[model samples]
Target chain A: MSIPADLKYTKSHEWVRLEADGSVSVGISHHAQELLGDMVFVENPTVGRKLVAGEECAVVESVKAASDVYSPIAGEVVAANGDLEGAPETLNQDSYAAWMFKLKPANAADLDGLMDATAYAAHVASEAH
Target chain B: MLKQTPLNAKHHEANAKLVDFSGWEMPIHYGSQVEEHHFVRNDAGMFDVSHMLPVDIKGEGARAFLRKLVANNIDKLQTTGRALYTCMLHEGGGVVDDLIIYFMSESWFRLVVNAGCADKDLAWMEVQRDKLAPKLSITPRRDLAMIAIQGPNAAAKLWAAMPGTRELAEAMKPFHAVVVGEMFVARTGYTGEDGFEVMVPNKAAPFFWQALLEAGVKPCGLGARDTLRLEAGMNLYGQDMDEGVTPFDSGLAWTVDMSGERDFIGKDALSRLPRNRQLVGLKLLDRGVLRGHQSVFTAQGEGEITSGSFSPTLNGSIALARVPVGIKVGDTVEVDIRGKRMKAAVVKYPFVRNGKALV
Candidate 1:
């Protein structure tokens, strides 16, 4: 529910924060974590991996089911979150802070295609009904 | 349309996350399932089990009818208020349903059956009764509601909630039942913990639920129920065994009274079939949860996981799998988890009992 205005979001419930260095850090949104319940395992894309827009690059598995973490923009994975491998429940604790992986955007302009916090909030609200 | 239990409104009021389970709208969890699981393990918790159907059999021929109806021998119930866990089967030796039958008297017996298989079970019983014992009366008590109070402190808390009922319940042994006016309290539960499954009149359900809550019994959901039952190594009817699976393969051969001079519905078929597979428990040596329908590869042959879950008690993944014969304890098996073959060790089940880990 806490969709920060500075961050961009995907319809698949991932939040992308575009850093000043032009790389985008991605993690699942608070709403996504709440829906999936307690997360037990999180598999992030390896560094240097190429990803296309809407590509399934990662997986977040809870006790109930497994969910694919789709890439919001075409990019090369620069860094994967090592902390998450030890404690996957951190995503459930604070999703926005626990970024899954960092990606060097293939095209800086692709960031504009993602929805802002307000638009993403509206999207999530619409899906509820 | 899904069936709604009497506590549906109450669960909604508590902000429960509802899911459609076996054609009934039931609460899967309130907020956090893991928290609910831990609560029951350390303290007391209650479950709204009104979806489970209770049928009262009454008549002079009640005992005789049940003797012919179920796989487990009912002659063991010589004393009143004794309960027996048994599986009802079709003529083909496949399990129809697993149920708990409590003998109140020679003419009065109460049966508690799974919610999903209630209708089919009732119809099957009716057909059997018509052909076997026409004088017996089969009454489905939809007018009653059930609640399971479980955990280490569950019985004491339940006693505190309903003051006078404890003395009578305390006198009763495990797997026994005692009727206190309109409420029938059984010292039984699906969880590995010690507790009581109390059945009361439908109208008094909300009141009793509230009273138990006031007594500090946490309201647990089905999420905790699954983890607890798995830890206990109890076989879930539809998941572990069904109309297509026999007791021998489902780890319930002991429950089938084949040795006694009693002729039940599935006796002949069971006696004739060759037992090729046996159900055993698996402890995963690798990281990841073991789930149902996962293919298990053993030294003997390929097998299937019947029921699997992450054990909250052991903090590891465990499962009940039906594997080919000759796979003994301490044997290593490979499980196909999401296309990856993971190693697991086969061990004796009943993973936890009386709040202690056995395997």
Candidate 2:
């Protein structure tokens, strides 16, 4: 799958979409779901939880193993994807559309520090070795 | 380089996710691992198990040789077509590998062992054969490949795929096998369901696989195989028990026959060693997945999970753990999952059998 040129990508395989209201919608990238096949469980960050950049915030579990979903930027979670806890396979189907949580960024400048689509795609390809 | 089975091209044709399992390039799933697991429980599914090795022992002393080489007694295999599950152990009672021995005839028996331990197991068996059963012909059947058709509709699909097998296999009981032309079909399986494990010539495996697929039996892979066997309370050889643990410590005491004065390779060591840890089932009361090598805190002491996974049948996380013998069923235990202690209940396993949850 091609990386979305509009969204900012993280080295940890998360995609960040800047919303109109200054909140950021966060979800795992398509490559992440392809690596973790057949998701079974998901736990999103609770609303109102303060998250620091690089901190482990949410979790996604496949039939094989569990992985920590790290926060891409310092933020406070305003809303979480409630449907994911019961229907984790939604992430496997369309990870880009299945946002896990929405966060209000503590510092808007932090978004500039994230990787662009090209850099993130190159990073993913380099990790193949 | 990873090894490929006879059905490698077939799996690729189906667009399976090929993963490395014990150095073999095997499919983890066709599309979804969880879906394949449910297919085996509710309908028919076939698994390519050619990675496992089958050895044939043919001689006058075949039975006598096996009687001393394994932990289980073969005297119980009075019937010619009977199949016995047993553990080949080292001199110190640690398991070398667990295998199934089929009593084909008075002078012929076949043993199916694990893929990862095949080389070591064959060496051990060959050494035992040279010293004790000198005239016995021990041959590894690499010329053949194995496929296991499992689940509720497994027998029906097998019958539909192979027209002549129903007559030879209809009245066959569990733990029994029948020779049908070039195929050796056994009424046995790792999943706790009615099925057959068929051994076919390497050249015929893909055709037979296609026949079964045409008969509506879907292809399942190693990922589903692990979870299904785990839910059935079966042990994975290296994960649950190895040369470091005895059969008694790994929920396989029933396979060990101590009825008579049978001095198997590990009997003396088993008799001399102290009974310390025991295997039990654990049902997670909290959220999150249970994985192997997690620490378990009990009233007795700390133990470790041998095999753990999210059971698709149970829709809950379950595990087989080696804990202190003092811990009883209905007791509560805490599992350290990723540094967090999660509440779990101790329960008797075979968590799901015949498409039903028993825990």
Writing each residue's lDDT as its tens digit, candidate 2 over B1-359 gives 99999999999999999988888999999988999999999999999999999999998988889999998999989987899999999999999999999999989999999999999998998898899989999899988999999999999999999988999998999999989999999999999999999999999999999999999999999999999999999999999999999999998999998778778999988988888889999999999888999999999999999999999998989999999899999999999988889999999989999999998
Docking class of 2: high
Question: Please, what are the lDDT tens digits per residue for candidate 1 over residues B1-359?
Answer: 98888898889989999999998999998987878888888899999999999999999989889999999999989998999999999999999999999999999999999999999999999999999999889999999999999989998899889997977898788899999988999999998888999999989999999999999999989988988888898999888999998999999988998986889999999999999999999999998888899999999999999988777778778999999999999999999998889999999989998778888
Regions of model 2 farther than 4 Å from truth: none
**Between which residue pairs do clashes occur in model 2?**
none
Model-by-model DockQ, in order = 0.66, 0.89
Q: Which tens-of-lDDT digit does each residue in A1-129 have in candidate 2? A: 889999999989999999999999999999999888889889888899999999999989998999999999999999999999989999989889999999999999999999999999999999978
Residue by residue across A34-103, what tens digits does model 1's lDDT show? 8888787778899999999999999887767678999999999999998997798899998999999999
What value does the lDDT take at residue B293 in candidate 1? Answer: 95
Task: Output per-candidate TM-scores for chain A, rounded to 2 decimals.
Answer: 0.97, 0.98
Q: TM-score of chain B only, all predictions?
A: 0.99, 0.99
